[model samples]
Target: MNDEHDSAFDSVTSWIVAALGLLVLVLVWGVIFTFTVYSQALGDAFGLSSLRLSSIFSITTAAFYIAGGTIGILIARVPLRPVVATAGAVFGVAIGLLQISSSYLGLAVVFGLLGTAGGTMFVIVISLVPQWFEQYEGRAMGITMAGNGLGIFVLPPVWVWLLERTGIREAFVVVGGATVLVILVAAVVYRRPPELRAQGTAPVDVAWLRSNLTDGRFVSSLVGFALLWSWYFLLSADLVGILTTGGISRAVAATAFGIVGGVSVVARVASGEFADRIGMRVTLAVGTLLAAVGMVVLPWTGTEPLMYVLLVTFGIGLGAIAPLFSPIIIERFGPANATAIVGVFTVAEAATAFLVPIGLNLLLGVTNGYVVPLLTVGGLTLLGAGLFYRGTAPKTSPQL
Candidate 1:
């Protein structure tokens, strides 16, 4: 009877955590990605140049990945609730600081703090969800991570509406305050899974990270995933340009980009379910191949229909990648190592996000065409698939 009751309780709370996790991601990613809207508003209000405004966003992005990884490693001993609550506090304080300070330097500093908080909170919630379920872990993670795409889709327009009515400062204050309240409330209600309640939390030590990094399998997997995933950043930065260069109208090109974001939301959910059935490696491999093929065909697209098909294919691959990240790490390294591995892996991803697009743009400038850059990205993604497959083959040793 007690076992039955506990099982029922676990089922109930698992879904609750999943729902709240989704909400948190939506708000967090929404705020992070919507900086473009805020950038335009800030420029008009402060007379800041594009470079200065861009530097602020770049600072925030860098801090998010770097600080998140570093702090995640150090905080492996801490419990979940406090880490989450701290993120809430940091968000509230950062936005409050931004409200009162008008200087560019002040804004940059506050934004970096915000990014750090965002990164910490994101990893904590991601780590939290998988702890609750052994069976439907993929589905729960998918539901939570779908918020990433959903936020990108839903929040920008909402922010644009808010900015028009409330002004930039007032708008941030409102949203930031609401975010704080929701996160703190979530922290209050969140609990560790009953199965894990008696076990000591595993510490992610320097030796462990070193062992994992040096392993051939681990190194290959990281490099392969990063290379394949580079397409996401590459296309996000240049997709419209690629379309326009092929004689598509600017409006149509934008529609193609929007399709990627919209399709990704559904793909995230679908991919999670798919991963649960066939296995993470196969799902990931298939997604990479689909995206690679799309990129390989990108330069030749002439009509709007073809553009949509290519973007949709790429979007599915991109969407599948996000939800699998935590699960894949957990499967290979164990749940104890998931947070730290995710943190470090995220840093690699951030580097690709920052550097790959710049390289693509340089190639575009040099060759004066999209075909070479597009094909190069596709080729790299295919190589990534090959490496990731070999690296993730089932192993007996419990190393990284």
Candidate 2:
């Protein structure tokens, strides 16, 4: 009887982990691919220059600041249906509306209004990971980060294919339509475990959120991540253009994107596993430096083949940054307040996304090409690395 019960318990545990894992997969795809693919299309349609392209996606990214916690609250209060389905609605509606879009307002409405809505769905997905694997939260988050890589790997070739044949609008319809289906599946799969719900108190503390956000060490994490995300998202927003301008063909550039996504697949998973086995402070520092190196190298390589190799390496290095973000929060604050703190950090990062890309555009206006912008990204990266190192350094006791 004892053996039978143990076996059944293990089976159920396995199922819940798998369900949580799949939920994370959809969210990761939504995060890494959807906005980026939209950014590419948005730029093409409006003659909206690359800098303003960030504006196109900025509203949705901005909404995460407000909505990330709201998503957690919804999951906390109701069954997972409302939170998950609402997210699905945003994704599906955004895609369906694509058939009607023709101008900047439409792009802003769908990408910003609807796209922001779609993106906010991810916070709920991530917030549930701790509920499923309380002690092993970091490892679970690492496992989940693979979803982003998977999306990155498959999405580029598919998006490039869609863009080439059907034009960007129809591509939206197809991708958006597919998103609705996944959203439904995501809604069904993601939930806070009953074990957590039975405890009465919420998984994370409300008071802690208020304290953590204002604290110095935590704020440093946010600032550091914002800089990291700015460059990471900027790369996603501009990869095709970057490679093509460096003399690689469009087909080759798209392949390079796929290569990045494929590498990111490993980076996300590896980063998480590395963090869990190692420590958040060290792992994040390494990711920041790798991404910094990746950002700087893109502008220097002269040959087409060399650009391809370096850009893919850059993508792999750059792509793994997000997985470390929540781990940093969890390590500092514990899992209970992870969502709220992460939401705040994400908001700050989104603001960086808005400002930095436009700033790069201005730099281009002044200097032409990516030389100055690349230099600026490298400087910010080094600055970010320095901040992390200093913040995490052993506090020296004041000299007696």
* TM-score of each model, paired residue for residue: 0.93, 0.73
Q: lDDT scores for all predictions?
A: 0.80, 0.62
The root-mean-square deviation over C-alpha atoms between each candidate and the true structure, in angstroms, is: 2.6, 5.5
Stretches of candidate 1 off by over 4 Å are 1-10, 397-400
Per-residue error (Å), model 1, residue 88:
0.7
User: Per-prediction count of colliding residue pairs?
Assistant: 0, 2
CA lDDT of 297 in candidate 1? 93
| Candidate 1 backbone collisions, by pair | none
> What TM-score would candidate 1 get against the native?
0.93
lDDT score, candidate 2: 0.62
Against the correct fold, how does model 2 do in TM-score? 0.73
| Candidate 2 positional error at 116, Å | 3.4
Per-residue alpha-carbon lDDT of candidate 2 for residues 317-399, written as tens digits (9 for 90 to 100)? 65446565565555455444444555666666667767776887788889879877887887787786665555444335221
